[model samples]
Target: MILEVLQLVPHPDTPAKAVPSVLCSLSWQDAGHWVAGFIVGAPSEALALPTPTRPARTDGLWQRTCFELFLRDPESGAYLEFNFSPSGEWAAYRFDGYRAGMRPLELADPWITSTDRDQFNAGMGAHLAALGLDPASIGTLLSTPMPEIPGAPAAPAQYVLNAHLEDPALGAAKTWQLGISAVIEEADGTKSYWALAHPEGKPDFHADACFALEMAMSR
Candidate 1:
């Protein structure tokens, strides 16, 4: 596997650190095509938690490879950590945060095997089952309009919002009006797409970042 270094940025928040602020972009390229890759960067000084050996799949569009640094709290033997997905999502994990004696909650979804259609279906099926939902009933529920979440105003079927990007090292920045969408994919391999936008901007510091992608065939 050939992994190319696309971009690198020094850490702005911390100085005198051996690991200069780093930002990298990577992609999988084969047969003269770029499949998908994401940006990875160090977010803070806190140690990273151990990454799970089993990868997770989300929405069937992207695959993620992750790495973390783990730290421990002396008093409780419990710890807090930072996690980075090569696909660009960063999150903080606390062993005990929300409820008493509960496991940490993942704030984002990182899906793998986007190009493998069959695996995608199976992954989605497993997700639905975990939700205690019957895949067979999704169709009927979609046909009937449902009420909005309590205390929230109803929104249009579609929505739009502004997006922005900022990075001091690269001297790069962007502002744009964008649309959001969502879709449902059935067990039979059908899909639906929708659009909506959030008030917050989606910032990507590694937009132009680049990296090499390769797979090991055989010995």
Candidate 2:
């Protein structure tokens, strides 16, 4: 039997052991528009997520291939989870506690806004400062237009950060923390979970103990 591989999940396995799944990533523009990027090398005929004729709020989407978002308010201690199936069907739930006080939440697709160079850099600097970092300690910010690179995506979803972070929240990582994830469904109806960082022993997207991807802002 011949099996094709999907690049949606950033598995640690070698290409030889890579399974049929998609590699998914997401980027949000400072609470503006959030966009998801999926690296699906395998053709639809080979591997496809569930897509319904009419997209609607439906349950059991997670049992299949689906995109998800988890947002939380640190002050209010309330959070929301959103599920989006490739089929256009979606669902959302609100929780006042971990796996508690479940309720339905309404939402619409957020616009995908382009990040301007200046605005992006300024936001970066502001966030660093908010974390009590000296402006001089930070590396030189991107001050000019970036030259094109080979094999670069037609549109990039992530930013190229060359600065180092020295905070308790982020000891030295060079990326933002936000909650984003996906479940890739196999032809036989199996699934695997993927996220920015799964700290728990098992797959738990709602694990607010850490961030999948957190939005940063300046006061």
Candidate 3:
């Protein structure tokens, strides 16, 4: 699995201090496994990171330096939000549509580890049942071709790397639009929002425009 290195840009209104940049890499593994790595190009002492603690599900992580992932199913408009903190804490939430009907998504806790305050790694696995997806249907969709739209340019066939299609029984093979973002807090309490893409005005990670990375297994 090739990890795609992506550069996250800070919102224009909220410029970063001390933190030079944030690089994120994501790769999918077989059998519902995926890993994300983040490298913060900044002095470890310049950022205000939460103190180390026993890994557990915690709320309000984004208030500090936190890494976030937003996954959306294009067809259904349902999405999952995962938050990983440098302190080995994590949170997961499910939304019905565009932030409606939110609830805690209880699953096996993600394994999060960080190197000082400059680098972090998060790994997790979720079954199709947990995501409310039908494995057989997704398998069929993967085998079928998409209907072309009128006047639209032809699109090349694309699939998520390491989608595990060889074994449809795995049940967690499907397409997803991912939005990666982070909230960086400086030692002096300055906060900046970073993301692959930002909406027009304020730094809104929940906006649809932020979900720009397309990893289609069967779009």
Candidate 4:
């Protein structure tokens, strides 16, 4: 499993008036599951969060305060986007390249939970397979070999397994550039855009430059 602890910075022109910080954690398990957790460093009453409701796939969650995840294939430039609301609503979209050819990414419902108006969590099942990857191929990729390094000690078996997870020859199923972002709205209606990185000009969560985090996946 690969785990990342990350922080989101507000876009230079759009600063949070009430939210002090946004810290996030992402974990990718070998079983093809993903869990994302976020801590909004402010009282729930201070933000204009969505009303709680039954968990379901919904659109336009980004219009207000919402957490998001972006996964891109570096080689083909294809990507997927997910929006998670504190109210248990969510959305998923796939792009052909960059932000082109968008369509819903169908999958089983993800489990979501929130607490204390400060913490939010979303858990998703085998999304790699849902993204059109063959289950058998993923198992093979996990065992792929790594090239030898001259004058360097041999890597452990597990290290080799992780290193080759990004082999492009195997296709987009194995590697990804990740982006974590959020649209935060204060109770009084002030809004801020937070992301790992932002492009100059406007707050475009779909910007390629914002997908700053990288991941190499195994089985």
The clash count of every prediction, one per candidate, is: 14, 12, 0, 0
On a 0 to 1 TM-score scale, where does candidate 3 land against the true structure?
A: 0.73
Tell me which of candidates 1 and 3 scores higher on lDDT: 3
**How do the candidates rank by TM-score, highest first?**
4, 3, 2, 1
Q: Tens digits of per-residue lDDT for model 3 on 85-187?
A: 8776778888889879899986676666555421221111123433565545455544455687899985322111111112222225577888999998888
Looking at candidate 1, the ten consecutive residues that score lowest on lDDT are: 158-167
**Better candidate number, 2 or 4, judged by lDDT:** 4
Question: What TM-score quantifies how close candidate 4 is to the native fold?
Answer: 0.74
**lDDT (0 to 1) per candidate:** 0.28, 0.50, 0.71, 0.71
Clashes of 4: 0
TM-score of each predicted structure versus truth? 0.21, 0.54, 0.73, 0.74
Model 4, runs deviating above 4 Å: 116-173
lDDT of residue 163 for candidate 1: 11
User: Which pairs of residues collide in model 4?
Assistant: none
On a 0 to 100 scale, what is the lDDT of residue 166 in model 1?
Answer: 14
